[model samples]
Target: MSEVTDLVEMLEKTGIPMSNELIEALLRTEPSDFTDFPLESFWHDFPVPFLVTDSGVTKTISAPHMIVTMLHHLELDEGLHVLLMGSKGGYLATLIDIICGHGGKVTIIEPHDEIAEHTSNVLERRKQCGLIRVLGKEALEDPAWDRDVDRVLFTGSIREIPDFVELLIEEGGFILGPFGGRIQQRLMKKEWQGGAWLETDLGGVVFGPMDIRESERGFPDPLFIADEFEDALILISSVLGENSEEVYRLERLVESLRELPPGLPEITSSFTEEEIIEHPVIELLMTEAEWLNELWPTFVDILGFDLEGIVPDLEEPLFGKRHADFTP
Candidate 1:
């Protein structure tokens, strides 16, 4: 969103920039199959909890909007090598697998053994295990490779962006994740510009801790989290442009929407006319920009689909192929 020199050049390497193809890819691979949670939980546009560690910390797959947003900016293309810090239920990995094709490679570092195993089983079941390698943090000790990976992604929150991440990427590569304090973070982007990395604030998100043990930091301070967005609340402000009266008005609406309980209620499963208009998230999106109104409904339809019998196009990766992928 900046006109600065480094950020400008970094944007040129971006691929897919929208969520439609990602949604369609998701339909081909059932999200329910990747999680132990019930189907009801898997179908909503919210962070669905699938694993709880012995530490009593719960892990969740990011909401659909957040997933699409992260992958959208990740700039997936065929033949890329991506290093993922979190497994993301193998859901995100699988999506990456879809986009990267046979020439691509993914190395997922999942610190939790249970999650790592679960992700491996699902990928093997889907026959995608061949394209990805699931390992623990120990793998970082020896990141031996001839060239740098094209991208690095983190699905959870980190207190701050780690310095060592830059070593794992090439000149044009980038790292995308939530970087900030517990319970709230700015989704920051760090792009390697050959000389140095340039950063961009992708907006706010409240992903789970990078380590379940991070709960020791104490509960979220409302003072800090008051500005955070949960589930699809991030979407309301994601594409809003430069600081202006319109942006402020939308921010006010986001404040109101944030007051609602996290995750969509069961009513969203079966949308009636009254329910669509009355839904706070939908209202916020439709009111933010007239064109964006279509996006929310489109997501509703995609999330409501039956994934049982659909088949995805494995020969060709769909991400970054859309017209929107052409520009920064």
Candidate 2:
């Protein structure tokens, strides 16, 4: 308690817009209650990764700063329903559940299987968060999210508003998340008004590259990018066996990526983002970026696209919503 209290004070001193109610509510539980991450991690103002692999850090509890920024912007209070995407290892959900209280509901949709399992274990172990429900992509068949909610938070980054907002939310309330490209983005708040959503850029933020696999750069390395280019084409060709100049052109792009030092002595060039489409599941992605919205739904299930890869550039999240089973 002392350590977390000190951490909150530090955040306040740094001008985090934490209200007395939130601070007091948060103190009732600890980050440890939700995650087995190191205790020292809970005392800092940095993201604490709970899920990691050779693919890189797939998920993390938002740093204290980001957490407070989101909480303040969310305008959370008792009895407001909140829909959250991604578990953040259950830490953020726990806080939201506390703030919303017994009368309120906090529904979390965690796309990753392991992450969702971890969060469910955490919630089950910590019985205090009685108002929260964590649902994985499979359980999503029940359409629980279709209900009205006061707010929606995408823990990972997104490029556009989720399509479901039209039917899931009335012409009122807010949707908050970081929106933009995989490399850069800003927190955006969309307020429903006059049967339309008015957008506001809250501030710049570095969000989850949300790619299932990544290197130092959230995007795959140059060589891997080439491999994926080849993979995407193959997947498309597998589905639509017809060949064309566009396929040939894309094949050449893949070859260019594969162009390494001709000899063991070796040479290579760094591929720019433009040359390398960033999302990890390129093979699963539509070969033609322009046709994604149209092709995504019919093809994604066959590709087995999952929640872990959220596919930042994907326009329609519905196609990207298949329950995830990752490569070992």
Candidate 3:
């Protein structure tokens, strides 16, 4: 059996809800280049896909559900031409193949020549070929990819949304990928409306790497503040419309405060837990804000020039320290 079929069988045995035989039937016939067992680093915790890298081989985790979620959100169907950049082990591409079937076309652009060759050979040997294609090229210079696709997917992160992506879409096509860095990403779709693009940010997510520009080294701080306050505000606004209950609470909070504060510390201190719980939108704001606050600190600690911000002994909260609060 091909490595792809073997993997599907393994996932099925692990209760991942997939059928190896069914998947094999759907796939195009291709030969297996991988005869020896793939090697995974000892540090890996999950079944990360692997590729034959020049520097011995590297493995990384991939979220199958995450891709499915993006596809469903885009309302993707057959007939859509998709461009996938940064092929990760061809596992994700296999899933997409099932979804797109033979009617839809998927072209994968990979920079790693060895990885490209392995994936290309496997697909060609499997008899489930033709509907899928592969190319070994740098994403930064691919002029043909500019605005020529119905949906563009970047498995890796991008420092900035490429102009080529805008050219690929046909005024209404959607593109999804990591916007900032590989550390964290928010799945976003841009719709061409009027004369400009309208952005819809889904939420914070963790993902595998992408075809990043050589100049792109670290995460680019987004224009909006990365603190708890901004997180809450953005989430509440996105969920409830202008006249919703959440919006009213935000307005009330703004009105009560004399001036805008710099960080979440000020906002949290200003209002009591009771006040926050009573507000319609403050609940969601609080949740997202707290999450962002927890995330930003870690990102900073890891990426900051001076490692002084690092929390050395970080541990999960001991929430139930005083289990029984009533006096005996």
Compose the digit string of candidate 2's lDDT tens values, residues 76-192. Answer: 888888888777877787788888877888888776667778788888877654478887654545665455778888887766775654446556788999986544578999988
Per-residue error for 135 in candidate 3, Å, reads 1.1
Shift in Å, residue 123, candidate 2: 0.5
Q: Any runs in candidate 2 off by more than 4 Å, and if so which? A: 53-58, 138-145, 210-328
lDDT of 2: 0.65
- lDDT of each residue in 114-149, candidate 1, tens digit only: 888877887888866237989877676675744468
TM-score preference between candidates 1 and 2, better one: 2
Q: Give the local distance difference test score of model 3.
A: 0.51
Off by over 4 Å in 3: 1-47, 138-146, 215-328
Reference-based lDDT, residue 280, model 3: 36
RMSD to the hidden true structure, all candidates: 18.0, 14.7, 12.5
- RMSD from true fold, candidate 1: 18.0
Please, what is the TM-score per model? Answer: 0.58, 0.63, 0.52
- The residue-by-residue lDDT of candidate 3 on 1-328, one tens digit each, is 3544554455455553334423443244221232233333211224344564777756443543454355455555656677787766565565566666667777788777888887787667554422778886555466545555777787766656676556667767777776765455677776666668788887777664464443232211112223222334444455455676545654554443424333323223355646544343333333444233333343333333221221122254311122121112
Q: Give the TM-score (vs. native) of candidate 3.
A: 0.52
Return the clash pairs for model 2, or none.
261-267
